[model samples]
Target chain A: MMTRTFLVALIGLSMGSFGWADNPNKPDDNTTPPSAETSVSPLPTITGGLVFNSTFTPGTQSYSPVVNPIVLVPLGNRFLFESEYNVNSDLTRDHGAWNPRQLNREIEYMQLDYMVNPHLTIVVGRVFTPFGIYIERYHPEWIRDLQVAPIIFGISHQQSMGAELRGAVHLNSKVDLTYTGFYAFNSTINYFTGDRGLGGRTSLFFPEKGVEAGFSYNRRLGDNRFNLYAFDGTWNMKSIPLDLRTEVFKTGMLGNGYWVEGAYRLNKHSHNSFLRKSQVVLRGEQYFTPSAADMAMTSMSGMMMGDNFLPDQNTTRGFAGWNYWVSDAVKLSFAFGRSFALGENQNIYSLGITYRFATGGSEK
Target chain B: MKSTLAIAFLTSLLMAVPAAAGNPSKTPHSHEIDGEAAYKANCTRCHIAIHTYSARSERTMISHMRVRANLTKDEADAIFQYMAGEQKPKAAPTHTAKGAAIP
Candidate 1:
C-alpha cells in the first residue's frame, strides 16, 4: 500500500511540475528572456491507459488490473526519447478464496529515435520486436478489439534490445512502402533479456484504400536455432465503420497458427445514441501442433522456448464480443468464447473496463 | 486444408481491390488533399479518440505516429495541419520538404 501511494504521489508531482494541468488559453510564461527568435521546445508528455478485467471459466475466476504508461520526451527537432511500462496484478479464486499474485512489472520498450529525413529514422535501445502488427500496434489493452490475445501470440518475441531502421516511402500516388530491419543481441539482464536474432518486416500500404499487408521474417541464432515467419493484414472499410484484420505465423517445430478478426462500430450508420456508442467484434483462430511428441517437448522447454500458455494439443477457438464507449477515454467490454481441444470443450467469459488518459499535451 | 486457406486469403485480397476501387468518392482529388481525411485514413485504426496537445507536443506525437503507423510524409503533415487547425486553403498547394506539390 505504501509503495502504491508513493507511486501515485510521484506521478502526480511529475505532472504538476510539468504544468500538465495548466490552462491552454493562458499566455506564455513571462519570466523567460523574450527573445523573439527563441523557440519554445515541446515539453515531455505522459500518455497511456488502465484496464480492469474479470473473467470466468468452468472451475475458476480471475481478475486482472493493469496500468500501461508511456512517456515521450522530445530532445530536439529530429530526436526523441520514449519509454513504456506495464504494471499488472492478477487475483484468482482458489479453493473458494481469492489469492492475489505478485505484481508483475515490465518495461515494454525504451528507445531513442532520430528522424533523419522524411523517409528514414534511426532507432536504438530496447524496442518491441518487429514481428507482426499485433505486438507493436494492438497489444495494448485499450486498443485491442478483443480482450484475449490471438493463439499465435506465443510465437512472437515480445521485445528486443538492439538497433533498428524504419521508415516509409511513397511508391506512387496512392501506395506507400514501409519497412523495418533490426538486429538484437542476446542478453540475460533482468527486465531486459532478449534472444540474439535478426529480422525485418516490410509492408505495402494503400492509404487511399485504408489497407495494409505485411510479412515478417526472423532468424534466431544460437542454441535455439530456428526461423519464424509471419504475415498480417488490416483493412478499414471506406463504405462502413468496419475493420478486418488477420495474422498467420509459423515457427519451426513448435507450432503454427492463424487468427482472423472483424470489428464493426455502429456509429456511422446509426442515429440512436446507444447504438452509436456500441461496437461488435468476432474472432476465429486455430492452432496446430506438429505431433504429441513435439507438444511434450515444447511443454518441457517452458515459456522461453515458445510453450507459454498453449494447449498440449491442437485447438480451435471462436469469440464474440461487444464494447460500449462510455466516453472517448472510457469503455466497457464483454466477450464470450468457446474453445475445442482434443476431447474437451470449454466456454470462456470476460468482462472488462478500460480508461485511457494523457497529460502534458496541449489542453485542447 | 492449408491450400484452401491460402486460396481464401488470396480471394479476400483480390476482393478488396474492387471494393476499394469502387469507393472513388472517398479519395481526395489530385489537386487538393484533405487533412482530416488523411488523418482519419491513417490514424484511426487502433483507436478513435483525438487528444489535443501543445503545438510542439503535437508535432512530436505525430512524428511518433509517423514511425509507428508507417505514415508517409504528406499524410503526417496533413494530419498535423488538421490537428493544429493550420490547414491551408483548398486552393493552395501543399508543398513537401522538397518543394514538390503533394498529389
Candidate 2:
C-alpha cells in the first residue's frame, strides 16, 4: 500500500512539472521557433552500461552479469527526473559444481531535481545518501576504475528515501564551496528500505588544479542510534593524466578503515597505440574491527553482523589492475589482488568487460 | 608504524603541491573558449566517455551538471557551447546568458 502511494505521488509530481513547463505565463514566446542551438521539444534520454565480471578466489569462483540502465526525462528547463536501476545475476561455484544463479534487481536511485538557481537545487525521492564521494560518484560499474569495492564501502548507508538540498557557491575566483544536506525517513519497504537519519557534506574544490577535499557526517535516529564520519579527497593532475583519491571513515565503534587509489591513463603515446588506450590502477586498503569482548561491553552488543561485503576480521589488501579502452564506449579490464586476514591469505583475480551506451542523442 | 608514516607522507604530498600549476588566465577580452579543454578539465573527473545528446537535452544536462559539479556559470556556459557545438571558434563574452538563469 505504501509503495503504491509513493508511485502515485511520483507520477503526479512528474505530470505537474510538465504542466508547469507548458503554462502560458512562461517568459519564452511560444510562437517563436527555437533557434538552431536549442531543441523544439524536450526529449527523454536513456544512458547506462552493461558489465560482465568473473572473479576467482582461493576455493570459490563467481560470475556476475549486470545491466544498469538510467533514464532521464527533462520536464522543462528547470525540472529533470532521473532514475537508475541495477539488475544482475550471480553464479558461483564452491569446490563443487556451479550453483544455481541468484538473481537480484533493485533501484539504485530514482529522484526528481528542481534547479532553483545556480546556487541551490531541490531533490526528492530515493537518492544516493550524501555521505562520502565514492557512493555518489564512483559506484557506477563503468566509472569505477576497480571492480571490487573498497574495504570501508560498507560503513555508510548507500541510499535514502528523502529530500536533499544541494548546491555550489563560488567563494572566489579559484575556490568553490559545494554543500549537501538531507533527511531520510525510515522505511521497511523492500528495495526502498532506509534508516531514519540526517546527514550533510561539504567540500572545497579547486577547478584549475583539479583538487577537492570534503568531510561528511551522518546520525541515525532510530533504534540503531549511531554516528558516521568520513573524510575524502581527490587530486587530478593537470600536466599528466593521473588521478588520486582517498577516503577514511569510522562508524560508532563498529569498524574503521581507509582506502587510497590512483589511476594513470597512458595518453602520451600515439592515439592508435595500445599503450595509449591503457590505464594502470593501484589501490591499498585496510579495515579494523573491535574485538568480540570489546563489543560485548557496549550497548551495541549482539549487533555485530557478518556479510560478504564486509570483512569479518581485521584485513589489509592491495590490488593492481589495468583497463584497456576497446573503443570510446567499451572497456576491458583485469585485476589481481591479495587479501591478508587473521585466518588466512587469499589471492583474488577478476576480469570484466563493460559497454556504455546512450540513445536518442544527436551524433557528434 | 611504517604504514602510518606512509599515509601521513601521502596526505602531505597531496596537500603540498603548488596551487599555481596550470592556472588558467583570467583575461577580460572576448575570445574563443576551447570547449574541448574546458570539457576535459571539468567533465572528465567522473565521466569516462563523452555522450552526445540533442541540443535541448544537452542544455538540460548541463544545467543539471552545473549544480552537481558545482561549476561556475562561466564554466557551465563554456561546456554547453562545446557539447552542443553552438558557436565554433566564434568570439563571445564569457558571461552570456545562454543557459539556465542562476541568480
Instruction: List runs of model 2 lying over 4 Å from the truth.
Output: A1-41, A270-272, A290-308, A362-364, B1-38, B67-74, B86-103
Candidate RMSDs in order: 13.4, 10.3
Task: State the TM-score of the second chain for every model.
Answer: 0.51, 0.51
Q: Is the docking of candidate 1 incorrect, acceptable, medium or high quality?
A: incorrect
Which portions of model 1 miss their true places by more than 4 Å? A1-40, A292-308, B1-34, B86-103
Measured by lDDT, the strongest candidate is 1
lDDT of 2 at A19: 35
Q: Residue-wise lDDT of candidate 2 within A228-339, one digit each (tens)? A: 7899999988777788999988874567889999998776644646776678999999998855654554344323321125666899999999988776677789999999
Candidate 1: tens digits of C-alpha lDDT, residues B1-103: 4323332332333223223322334323322446777766676777654445566666666767777776544466666676667442221111111111110
Interface RMSD of each: 15.9, 13.0
lDDT of 2 by residue, B25-76 (tens): 3212113335555566667776654445556666656665665565543455
